[model samples]
Target: MFCVDALDVAAELALPAYFFFASAASDFAIFLNMPYLYPGLPSFKDMGDTLVHSPGMRSVRAVDMPLSVQDKELDMTKTRMYQFKRIAEGRGVLVNSFDWLEPTALKALADGVCVPGRPTPRLKEIAHGLESSGHRFLWVVRSPPADPADVFQPRSEPDLDALLPEGFMERTRDRGMVLKMWAPQAEVLRHAATGAFVTHCGWNSTLEAVTAGVPMICYPMYAEQALNKVFMVEEMKIAVPLEGYEKRMVKAEEIEAKVRLAMETEEGRKLRETLATARKMASDAVGDGGSSEVAFAEFLRDLEKSSMENGGCNN
Candidate 1:
C-alpha cells in the first residue's frame, strides 16, 4: 500500500491496515519469503550460476534477482528484505494480479521476484527486430537518457531517424507505425488489430496485455520484471521470452525470432488462445458475484466494522 509505513500508526490507533502490492503475486511471494531467504545467501554478485529456489515458482538465476538487492550492500539488502517482516504483520495484502494468472505464486503467498538501462544501442536493435519481423506493429519511441542514472530526466523529443537503423523506417513503413513519446496504452492494447505486445514486463503492462488477450514478447529492462517474465512465459504460458535480455543487449535476430514466433507460428496462436481464455477469466473474476467483487465487498465490510469499532474516527 502507499501507506505501508503508516501501519505502525494504524496499530497504535487499533486500526486495521492492508498492503496493496502493485506487482504480481509471484513477486509478492518473493517479498514474503525474503526475510527467510536473503539472510542465508551470499551477496548476489557472488552468486554466479546459483539458482535461488523460492516457493511457488521455478528456481531463478542469481542474476535474475531484483535489482535493489543485486548490487546493493548486504546490510541494505537486509533492510529492504526486512520490510516483508512488517508486511507479513499487516492485516492482509492486496495485489493487482488475477488468480488464474499466477496459481503457484499465489498459492505460495496465500503467496507471494534486474536492472537495465535504456540506451540508444538497445533501441536500434529493437528497431531492427521490428523491421525484420515483417508483422504489422505500433511502437512508441522515447529518447534515450543521456545518463543511465538520469533515466527520468526530461529532454528533447526523440529523433527516430537518427536512433533507428538506417533505412529501417522506410522498410517497415507499410507494416508498422512508430509514434513519438506516448500512446493511449490501454486503448492500443484493447484495439482489435493488436496481435501481440513487446513489453518490458512491467506489472501494469503485463496485466493490461493479459486483459486484452494479447500475447507478449517479454523484454524485461529492469526491476522484478525479469521475474514477471518468468511467470508469464514459463508459468502462465501466455508469453514468449526475448532471448539475450540478461546480457543487456537483446540482439536483433533474437527479437526477430520472438516476434515471428508470437505473430506467425502455431505456438504463437496457442499463446493467443490461452490469453483469450485468460481475458474472460479476468472479466469473470472482476464481474458481479465474481471473486474480485466478492473480495472487495468483504474488504468494505471489514473496513466498515473496523471503523465503527474505532468510534468512526471521533476517538
Candidate 2:
C-alpha cells in the first residue's frame, strides 16, 4: 500500500498489488473518482463556497479538496491523477480507518462508492499567543524556508533571538520550553502531562493524538491537512480549528483564545472526555472481533482466494 508507483513493477512481475491508502477513507473516495470529476473545471481556488459532492462524503466545499487534486493544469495535479488511475488498476485498496471511527465514510465504501509545511508565521505570533494564554507549553521551533522552492528543504537550526519577539523567551521562560527542529512527537503525545496538541493535522500525528486520548487545536499547513482539519473539527468533534490558519498567518489573539478554549474551559473538558472514549474505541477497533480486526480478516480471506484463483501467485 505504500508503493503506488510500484504497481507497474508488480504487473511486470505478474504479482498482484494493493494500495494502502494512508489518509482518511473520505479522501480516498475523492481520489478514486478525480479523473471524472476534474476534467473541465476552474481551479478549486477559484470556486469559492461551491460544494463538491463525492460518493463517500457529504458535499465538501470545492476549495477544501486536497490541494494536489484541486488544480487541473499543474503538473502535480496531473501526476496525482495518474496515480489515482494506477490505484484504480490495483487489486484492492485498504484504508487506515475503522468503521466505528468513520462509519459514514466506511459505509459508503461498502456500498461501492469509489471502488478505489509550515511557514514560520511570523514566529512572534505563536510566541505571544503562548505567553498570553498563560499556559505551560513545549514548542518545537524550526527556521522558515527561505523561499517557496525551499519549502521541502531541510533547514538549519533557528536563531531564536532573531526570529522570536524580543523578551518573549524571558517572559515565558518559567512556563514554556522550546526545542529546536524535531522532538519525540509520539513520546510527547503519550505523556500524561500533554494536554492538547497544536498540530498541522498530518495523518500520523492525528492518529498519535487520538491514540493518546489527547484533543487537538488544528492548524493545517499544507497538502490534504486542511481536509483533515475539516473532518476532525466538523465531523469527528475531536478538535477545534485554529482560526486564521487557512490564511497562513494566525494572530496571537486567535491563538490565545483557542488555547484557553482547549485548556481552561468547560468545552475543553468535554473535548478531553470525548477523546478518552475515542481512545478506547480506537483500541477496541484493532482488538478481537472489533471493526478493524474483522475487516482485516475479510481482506486476508479475499487476498488468499484471489491468490489461489491466480494459480499460487501472491496477490
TM-scores for every predicted model: 0.90, 0.91
The model with the greatest lDDT is: 2
How many residue pairs clash in model 1?
6
TM-score of 1: 0.90
Model 2: per-residue lDDT, tens digit, 1-315?
335789879778766788888888767766676666777567787896688776667677776777666677889888887887667778778888866567777777667666430004557898899899999999999999978444688788999999899998888889999999999999999999999899989888998899899999988877788888877887888999887775678999989999999999999999999899889999999889888889889889988887787677552
Estimate the lDDT of model 2.
Answer: 0.81
lDDT (Cα, tens digit) per residue for candidate 1, span 148-237 = 655568867999878888888888888889999899999999999999999889999998998899999988877688888877888899
| Residue-level lDDT for 36 in candidate 2 | 65
**Model 1: lDDT of residue 280:** 98
Whole-model lDDT values for every prediction: 0.80, 0.81
At residue 218, candidate 1 shows an lDDT of 88
Q: What are the RMSD figures for all models against the true structure?
A: 5.3, 4.3
Candidate of highest TM-score? 2
